[model samples]
Target: MHDTGDAETTVILDNGGHNIKLGVVGAEGPRLIPNSIVKAKHEKKRVFVGHEQADCSEKFSLFYVRPIERGYVVNWDTQEQIWEKSFSKFDIEPTTSRIAYTDNNYLIPALPDVSNEIFFDKFGFQEVHKASASGFVADHAYKIRRERCACVVDSGFSWTTIACFVDGVLIQESVIRIDVGGKALTNKLKDWISYRQLNVSEETHVINECKEDVCFVAMDFEKSMIEAKKRFDENMIEKRYIMPDFQTSFRGQVKGIREPLASDAPSIVLGVERFAIPEILFNPSDIDIDQCGVAEAVVESITQSPEDLRAALSENIIVIGGSSCFPGYRDRLLQDVRSMLPAEFDVKVSENVANPETHAWQCAEKLLEYPAQVAWINRKEWDERGDSLEYSRFFRTTVTSDELKATTQEFEQKGEKSPKNGEEEEF
Candidate 1:
C-alpha cells in the first residue's frame, strides 16, 4: 500500500468484535473509515473491504468478514487485508516518517485480556495501546472541570465496560467489565424473535439488522415489557424505518413498509414508550445478568475510591462509546445515578454534539489538549524505545497519579510548551 508523495498520517483503529473503526487524526477530526469486515462465502474470491466491500456486496456474492470475535481478532490475515485495503483508500502512504517513525505512534484499543502481539507486529504500530487506557485518555480529553466524580459506562458490540473517573482520569483499580454488550443483546433479541416470529438461522448480517432495527435497552423493564406486550396499535408503535436498498449502484429510496402489509415493508416498534427501554444499563439483572448495572457500578467504584468523593464524581459522569447513544440513555443514566448517590450529588451526562460511535476517537484526538503529555509518545520516540515497559510509563500516566506527575515534570523540563500555558509545544 506504500506510495510516494501521499500525505503521511497517524492512524487510530479500534478493533471491536462487531466492527473495526480506523481513521487518520486531522484538523477536521478523525476521519473514520469503518473496517466493518465480515465472514462470507462467495463463488469466486475478490478482495473488497470497508466501504468497497460494502459496495461490492450489493452486486456480488462477496460476504462481509468480521474478523474479530468477542473483543479478539480471530483472523489476522483477513484483518491485515482489511487494514491494507481500507487505509489505501485514503491515499495514506506506508513509508515511515518522523510521525510514522519508530517513535510516531499509532493508537488502538487493545481489547482487554487479548494478546496484542499480532496487532503490534502486523499493523506496524510500535505500540498497542490498551483500550481501557484509550478510553480513559478519551475521558480526560473532554474532562469537565468539576469537583464531582462520575462513572464511565461504555456499552459496545462486545462488552459493556464500566470505569470510574475521578476528575477526568480513569480509576484503574475501580474499572469493571461485563461480558454482555450489543452482540449479546442482539443474539438474545434474535432468539426471542426467532422463537416467536421467524425460524431462520442466526447470521451475523441478519442478526445485526435485527439488532439495529428491533433491539434497544429497556429503561423500565417490567413497565416497558408490559407496554410492548399490549395489543399492537399504530400509535403505540414507533415510526417505521425501512432498510436502505443495496441492490443498486445508486443511493435510492427504500420505503419502510408496515406490517400485515399489502404494500408496506415489515416494521418493528422502537421507543414504544418514552424513556422506557434504555434503562437496562442500571438494572442488568432484568436481562438476567445477575450483575449490577452501570449506575450501580459507578457507585461501587466511587465508594471504593472514597465515600466523600461520591458527590464529586457524580458531577462529571461521562458516557461515551456506541451504547451511550441509545435514546433516553443520558436521562435514565443520570436519574439512576442520582438515585444511588447522596441527595447532594449532582449527575449529568454529556450532551450529544457528535456521532456517539466516534466519541472514543474524539477522546483520542483531545489528547492534544493536555499541557503535560510526555506519555504522549510520538512515532519517532516509539521507534527508539521499542520497549513495552517504556510505553507503559505513558500508559500509567493516564491513570496513576505518580506517573502523571512525573510525566508532567518531564514535559515541562523537555522545553515542550503547553497550549493551555501558552508554550510552543505541538503535542
Candidate 2:
C-alpha cells in the first residue's frame, strides 16, 4: 500500500441502492454520513446529497432514484447528480484533494476492461482505489480486528458477494457473487403485495416502508415462516417510522399503516413484511436460483483454504454491507453459520462501530494515510501494468472449470489467496 501525504479528509463512498454512505476516513475511523442520492421528489432539482436528502423525503413527494443497479452504475447522469450533491455538502471548493474508494462493482462500466486514462481526469479523486465489495469489507475488517483470515458475506442492496481473505489480503479466486440481494427481496415483497392488493404504486410505497421498518433476517426460516403466517392484530403490527420531509423540514415520525390503500385495496400486515427479508440468505431458490444459501456459500469459499486455515477463516466472518443493517440480521447470520458449521468453528459479525456500510471506506482511509504510498499510483503504473494484467486478467474470469479447480487447489496448497473467482463467484 502507498500513501501520498497528510490527507486532510479521505472520502469513502460505499454506494448502495438503498443508501449511498459517505464518511471521512482518518486515524479514528469512517465517520458515516447517513445520506444518499435518492432525493425526495420535491428536492430533486436542487443539488441535494448525503444525509440532507434523507430529511426532505416527505416534503416534495420524494421521488427516489438509484443510478446503480445490481452494484454498477446503470445511469451515470443520475449518479453524477448524486455525487455532485454529496460533494457540495462539505462546503469545499471543487479543487479539494480527495481519495475516492468504491466497491469492485465499478468493473461493470465506468471502470471496465477498457483503459480510461480520463477516470482521474473526470472524478476529482487525487487517488482512487477500487476493490470488490467483499474485498473492501474484508480489508477493513482486517484493519480493525487484526483477523488474518475470514469470509465476508456482503449482503448489500443490489447483490450479495462473498470474499475470502488470508493474512489480511483478499484471495481473488475465493470471491463469490450471487444475484440475490435486498432489492430482490424488496421486489419480491412488492410482487407479494401486488398479488394481494393490485396496486403497484401504493404497494411499492408499502414495500419500501416495510423494508425500512419491518424487514429482518430469520435464523430459522422454516420455523419463522410458520410463525409469520399466523394472524396478528393491527396494534401488534404498527411500527413508528421517522418520516423525512423532501422539501423544507428535516424529520418527523409516522406509524406504518397497513390500512387498505383504497376501499377495495387489501390491507397490508406487518408480519408478512418482516418475514420476507431473511429468507433470501437461505433460499435464493425462492427467487428462482438453484444455488447455495449465503452460509453455504461462505462454507464453500472457506473450503478453498488449507485445513489449518479453516478455523481462522471461520473466526473472522465479518458481515458488512447495507443489507446487514436489517434488524436481527447479524444474529441470524451467526445462527445460520453455527447451525451448519462444525461446533468448534467461531463465526463473528461486525458491530455498529463505524457504521456497517462505511467500514470498508474507513479501512481505505487507514491505507491512504501515508502520502508516500499514495504517490506511487499513477497512470504510468497502470500503463506499465497493461490492460490485460491490471483490469482484464483480474476482473474478467473466462477460465474452464478444470483449470479453475486446479488453480483453487494450487492456491490452497500454497497457502495463498486472491479475491478472484470463476463462474460461481462473479461479483
Candidate 3:
C-alpha cells in the first residue's frame, strides 16, 4: 500500500450491532448507517448494505443479515461489504488513512486477530488501533470535564456492560456484563404483543420502532401496573400505536393517545408494556435471565474497584448506548443506585444528553485529538513481527482489575492517600 504521509487523515469506526458509526477524525461527527446487509423479498437478485437498504421501495418482507451478533462481528464477509460501502459512500480512502476501530469491551479472543488480519492484510490500511468502545467514552467524559474516574454503563443492542475507568484506563476485573439489551427488550415486546393483541413476531423492525417510540422505564412499577389496567378513555397510561401499512407508509409511527376513530386502521393499545419492557434491564428475572440489572451491575462493578474510588465512580457514572436513550432510564438508574449506596456517597448518573446514539463515536473523535502513535501498529510492524508481536502492547495504557486492586492495597498498607486525593480521608 502507498503511504499518504502526514496528509493521510484518521478514520474512527464505532462498529455497533445495530448501526455502524463511521467518520473521519476532526470531522463534525460520525455518520450512522445500518450495519445489516439485507436482501428483500421484492428484490432477491440484489444485496443491500449501509444506506443502500434505504433505497428499497418495498418495505415489507425484508430479511437482514447482520454482521454483528452479541456485540461481536461474527461475519467478516458481510462486515467487509458494509465497510466497503461505507468507505465508498463517505468518500473515504481506507488504504491511505489511519483507522481506529472500537470493539466490545469483553471482546472474544480470536476476533481481534481476525480484525487485525482484515484491516492489515486484506484492506491494506496504513495503521490500525483497536480499543474498547467504553474506553473511548471514558476518555470523552474526561476530556469534556465530566470526571477523571467514571463508571460506564453501556446498554447497547446485545448486552449491557458496566465498566470502570480511572484516568481513561479501563479496570478489566471491574467489568460486568448483563445479557439483557435493546434487542432482547424488543423481542420481549414482540412476544407480549403477539400473545395479547396481535402476532407481531414476524414484524421485528416495526415492533422495534414501537419500542423506541413508546417504551420507557417506569419509576413506579406497581403504580404503572395499576394505571395500565384502567380504561384507555379514562387512564393516562394507555396509548394507541397505529401500525403502518407498508404499502403507503414505509415505517410505522406513534400517533399519540386518542379516541379510536371510525376509519382508523389496525392499532394496538400499549399499556404497562411500555415501561415494563425496559424494566427488564433492572429485573432480568422477568425474562428468566438470572442476572443483576443494569443498576445493580454498576454497583457490583464499582465494588470490585479500589475502595477509595467507589465514591468517585458513583458520582461520575456515565450511561450511554441506544437502550439508555429511553425516557426516565437515567433517573430510574440513579434512584436504584442511590438507594443501594450509603448516604455519604454522592451518586450522580449522567447520560450523553446531546447525542445518545453516537456517544461512543463522539468520544472516539475526541480521543483522536491526542497523539496516540504508540497505541497504533502499522502494517510494516505487524508484517515483520507476525505472530510474535505482542497484542497487549497495543493497549499499554489499560490496567487489569487485579493490578488496580493490588496497587491500591499496597498504597493502603503504606498509609498513603489515593492518587487522586493525596490527603487521607477520615473513616
List all candidate RMSDs to the true structure: 7.5, 7.1, 4.6
Candidate 2, 158-235: lDDT as tens digits: 788787765445555566777787777777876775666544443344456557666677666667666655554523
* Candidate 3 Cα lDDT to native: 0.78
Q: After superposition, how far is residue 302 of candidate 2 from its true place, in Å?
A: 1.2
lDDT of 2 at 13: 62
Task: Order the candidate numbers by TM-score, best to worst.
Answer: 3, 2, 1
Best by TM-score: 3
The candidate with the higher TM-score, 2 or 3, is: 3
Cα lDDT tens digits, model 1, 1-427, are: 1121222445455554545555555656544444555334542555556656455554322345665555455666766676677657766444431121111111223433223333344444433334343344334433522222346666776666666654355556666666566666656654554565444243445545544544455556666667655654633434343433344322322223244433343333344422233344566675677888777776776665544444545655666666666666677677777787777665666553366566665555554233234233334444566556444654432344453354345544764322122222112
lDDT score of residue 10 within candidate 1: 50
lDDT of prediction 1: 0.49
Each prediction's number of clashing residue pairs: 36, 33, 0
lDDT by residue for model 3 (162-208), tens: 88987777776688889988889989998999999988877777888
| Shift in Å, residue 328, candidate 2 | 2.3
CA-lDDT, candidates in order: 0.49, 0.57, 0.78
Q: Which pairs clash (backbone N, Cα, C closer than 3 Å) in model 3?
A: none
